[model samples]
Structure formats: C-alpha cells, structure tokens
Target: MFFGCEGVCLSFGGRRILDKVNCSAEPGRINGLVGPNGAGKTSLFEVMSGRYTPEQGSVVLDGEDLTRLPFHNRARAGLARTFQSPVVPSTLTVGEAFRAARKSHRPYLSKHDAEWAARLVHLEVSWETPAASLGTFDRRKLLLACLVMRRPRVLLMDEPASGLINAEIDELDLIMRRLVDEYAMAVILIEHRLELLAAVADDCVVLDLGRVIATGDPLTVFDDPAVREAYFETPDA
Candidate 1:
C-alpha cells in the first residue's frame, strides 16, 4: 500500500466515530472512499492525515509508520491532502501564492517548476491575478496545482468535485487521470458523486455507521444491498 490506515479508531464525546477501519490506496490507481453523510469518511481522512490521533491502529505510507507524526511532518513524508473547501490566500496574487507553496519546505522549488505545475493542471489565469478573485473551479485548480508542485507521492482529495458544473467536472476528471497515469501517484478520493467514481475509480471501500460494509470495484460495491440500504435509509430511522 502506498498510503493507508489500519485498524483506525476515533471517538468524540465518548461516541465512536470510527471502528477499526482499514483502507488503502495504490500507486497509479484512484481509490474511492464513499459513504452517506456522517458515515465517518471525513473523520477517517483526519486520522490518516494526522489531524486527529486515532485511539488505536496506525497510518502508514510506503512501509513507514506515521501514527505519531503531526500533519506538517506527514506532508514532508509525501502525503498531501485537499480539504472540502479550496483555501487560497485572499491577500496574495496567483504568483505570490504559488511562490509560497514552492518554498514551503526544503529543496525550495523554482518559478519554472511552479509554471510546470500550473500547466499540468491547465491553470491559465494571469500570474498577477488576485487569488481571491478566482471562480470556484479556478480556485480548486490553483490549490491542486500548488500541491502537485511539491511532488507528493499520495494525494487525498475530499469532495473535489463539489460545486463544479458538469463541464468543469469533466476537466477535473481528466486532471485526476493524468495525476495517476502520468505521475504514478496514489490518489484517494472522498466523494458523494457516484458517477465520477464509477468513471474513474479502480476500486472502492464503502463505509456505513463507522464500519466498512463493502469493498470491491465501484460498480460491484455500489450494488451491494448493504450499501444501497445505507444510502437510502432515513436520517431519523
């Protein structure tokens, strides 16, 4: 496994949020993590990314144990994640933001490197444009470009397709494929959009009420009765 969490457990206010969950991603493949709202998908992401310390189990990347490392240290170890909202510095221009991302850690990157990363994601806005002025899709592309500039080995994306129009989603779909097929990075996606997963995911792990109820190809996993029930169940049931 290039990136994964094993036997992860988390709780809040004495209520279990995750229960011995195991999930992984492989290089050159897109692993889809899907479940209904409040199914613990985002919570598991927090544990894997070191934002929340699990009560048990560990987060591993390329055979190295990172259970105790902080989020910055995990980023240094080639693990990068995107949040549900695209956060770009409102005070900085596109060029300034990219420069900061380039110089964020050791082995500082160059302008050419930043340009290459921007081109990889088809970010065509003027470098002088204010980041806060970008539209939703452009903002997303900008953040993703920044992460790619660091050359991470694993990318965890949370609801990346959210708020995107159909046309924009098509563009994102292509970018994701390139990230896997061309860059060979292991990509794990947390998404509610099943069509996107069905089109791109190599495999999927479905969680329900803090437990994994199915694991297989997207088509097969989506077909599982347990998964269907979970998705369709009434909130107050």
Candidate 2:
C-alpha cells in the first residue's frame, strides 16, 4: 500500500502554494522531496498531514480519501510526522516524552517500544535524563523516537538533516534507509541537501514555485535542467 497526494492545490492571499502536485510514497521505500526554499515542500507536508486542506485535491491513504479528515483521525489512519525542529517538553525525561507522545496513539506503550526507538536514533543517555540536558542532535533524535512509537503506515519528515554534524548525518541516513524495512511504513523525506537524498532515497520529486518541475530517481531529478536552473543556473565564473 502507498500514501500520497493527487492533484493537490492550495494558495494563500492569491499566491499559489501548490499546483496539481502529485506524488506517492510506498512501504519499504524512501521518497525524497528536494527543492529550493518556498517550493511548497513544507506546504505539501502540511496538506498531507491534515494541517491544511487543499483547495482542489485529496490526500489518499490506501484508497480511503482522507482529504477531509482531521489530523488526529489521520494519525489513526497510520500517518505520522516530524517537524523541522524538535518539540519536546523541557522538563520531561527521554522516556517520559516518548510516553507522553505515545499516549494518544496507543492506550499503552511498552518500554520495549521506547527502547526500540531510542536505539534507532542511537540514543545512549539514560531514559531518566531531562530532555533539556541533551544536545541538539540528541533532542532531535528524541523527537524522532517519539514519532516512531505509534508505528504509523506513513511518515512525513521535514528537514531531517538540519543541524546535524557529518557523523550524525551518516547515522541518520543509515536509520532512514532501514526504517521502511524495519517498520513497514512509507517514508517521505523533505530536505534541501542533495547528498542526503542520493544516499538514502529510492525516488524523489522536485518542486518549484508550487508546481512540480520534475520527478524520478533522486539523481535524475536533481540533474534535470529545470532543477539545476532552479538552484544553480547562475553563470560559472
């Protein structure tokens, strides 16, 4: 089964944010979304996650039209997401944060599930340590750990590579590539870094100014003339 948007369109104050955008994400495959800033990548994420309703399109999950479903209902449909930055309680410990995020998704979440997520992110600190005590990378990892607790059918991630060092980036790349197989979920990753996409994504779609400019394997899409122009059409001096 796959999850995605079809002909999704949206706008704000007459300025278009998405135009007939279509892309599908399937289980056991990582779908990458790459484009210049303001290319509607995050906007599309919002639509797919039920934060925004497209003016003229539907968000479908396994043949059920989720276009009008609320975000909570969408979660019940096995859709999960992570933001550009970590949003965790400063006072809560690692385990507590995961437990709290786990509550709405499952009536009871075991320590094993939390440990599995922690291990996925390579978290080494004690579960009792306050979230505020962890470094940026660790806190971000905790956020990811929280999202994976529910084992959603699809996961939408925005800028998973942000604020990570080289080693951390490498670790995250490994985790992402394996997540699909381990969890049986479709993953949609949105980021600006081409290297990350090439290293992990099975396929990618390129967007520009609210419209799709190209879609294919990550390398092919990135190499498209339109994509090159969008980011690096400037004269080589």
Candidate 3:
C-alpha cells in the first residue's frame, strides 16, 4: 500500500463514526471507498487527510507514519485531497486561482506547471474567466487541476463526480486513468456512482456503520453478499 489507514477509530459526541477501519490505496491504482449515507466514509477521509484525529490507528504514506501530521503538513508530504463540493475561490480569476495554488507553499511552482495541470485536465477556459462563473463540470476540472499541479503521491477525492452528466463523467474517467496509469499517483475516491467506480477503480472497500464490510477487486467486493445487503439494499427493503 502506498497510502493507507490502519485500525482507525473515530467518534463524535460519543457516537462511534469509525471503528477499527482499515483501508489502503496502491500506487497507480484507483481505490473506491463506498458505503451507505452515514457509513462514516467522509469521517475516515478526515482522519486520513489529517482534518480529524483518530483515537487509535495510523495513517501511513510510503512507510512514514503520518497519523499526527497536520493537514498542510500531510499535503507537503505528498498528500492532497478534494472536497465533495468544488471550491474554487469565487473572488479569483482562473489564472489567479491557479497562481495561488502554485505559490501555496515553498519551492513555488512555475506558470508552466500550472499550465501543464490545466491542460492535463482539459480545462479550456480563458485565464481571465472568473472561477465563480465556471459551470459544475468546469469547476470540478479547475479544482482537480489545482491539486494535480502539486504532483502529490496520494490523491483523495470526495464525490468528484457529483453533479456531472454522463458525458462529463466519461471525460473525468479518462483523466483519472491518465493520472494513475501515466503519473502513478495513488487515488482514493469516495463516490456513490457504482458504474463509474466499476469502470475506473482497481479495488473497492465497502464500509457499513463505520466498519469495513468487504475489501477486494471491485467485482468481488461488490458481489459479496454482505456488501450487497448493506450497500445495495433498497430503502424500502
């Protein structure tokens, strides 16, 4: 595993949100994290991304324990994450947003780096365009470009495909594949769209009420009786 959490446990207001949860992402692979609405998937992402501290467990990236590292520190250590919502700064122009991301930390990235990332994600907007004016799909592209510009080893994306149409999702699928197959970054994606996950994810981890229910290749994990019963079961069932 290039990046993973081991024995992670988390709670909020005395309610267990994650219990002994274990998940991992491999280099050059897409790992899908799936679960019911309250399955603690987002909370686990918080732990892995350092937004929340776990009572027990370790977050490891390339053999280094990052359990206690702050979010920015983890980002500096080759970890980056996108939110469930596309959060481009509304006040900034497309160029300004990219510039801010490039200059976010020391060893400032050059304009060429920003350009490369934008092109890689197929963001065709003009530099002068206001980030707030971008449509949902374009906003998603801009945010993804900002993160990839840093060349992080681990990328954690939360519901990136939300609000995207099928055609846009197809484009995103191509981009994700290139990121893994060409750039060799480890990607952990939290998504409800099983069709997209089935197409892109190399592995799947199913969580139910904060506990891992299954982990394996997507087909096998999705087919597991427990997983089907827990995740695929209809509300009326």
- Indicate the residue-level lDDT of 108 in model 2: 72
Q: Give the poorly placed runs of model 3, Cα more than 4 Å off.
A: 235-237
Best by lDDT: 3
Candidate with top TM-score is 3
Considering TM-score, which of the candidate structures 2 and 3 is the better prediction for this target? 3
The CA lDDT at 74 in model 2 is 95
TM-score of each: 0.97, 0.95, 0.98
lDDT per residue as tens, model 2, 56-110: 9889999999999999999888888999987679988887887787675546778
lDDT of 2 at 152: 78
lDDT of 1 by residue, 59-80 (tens): 9999999999999999999999
Q: What is the lDDT of residue 59 in candidate 3?
A: 98
Where does candidate 2 stray beyond 4 Å?
Answer: 235-237
lDDT of each: 0.93, 0.87, 0.94
Candidate 3 lDDT: 0.94
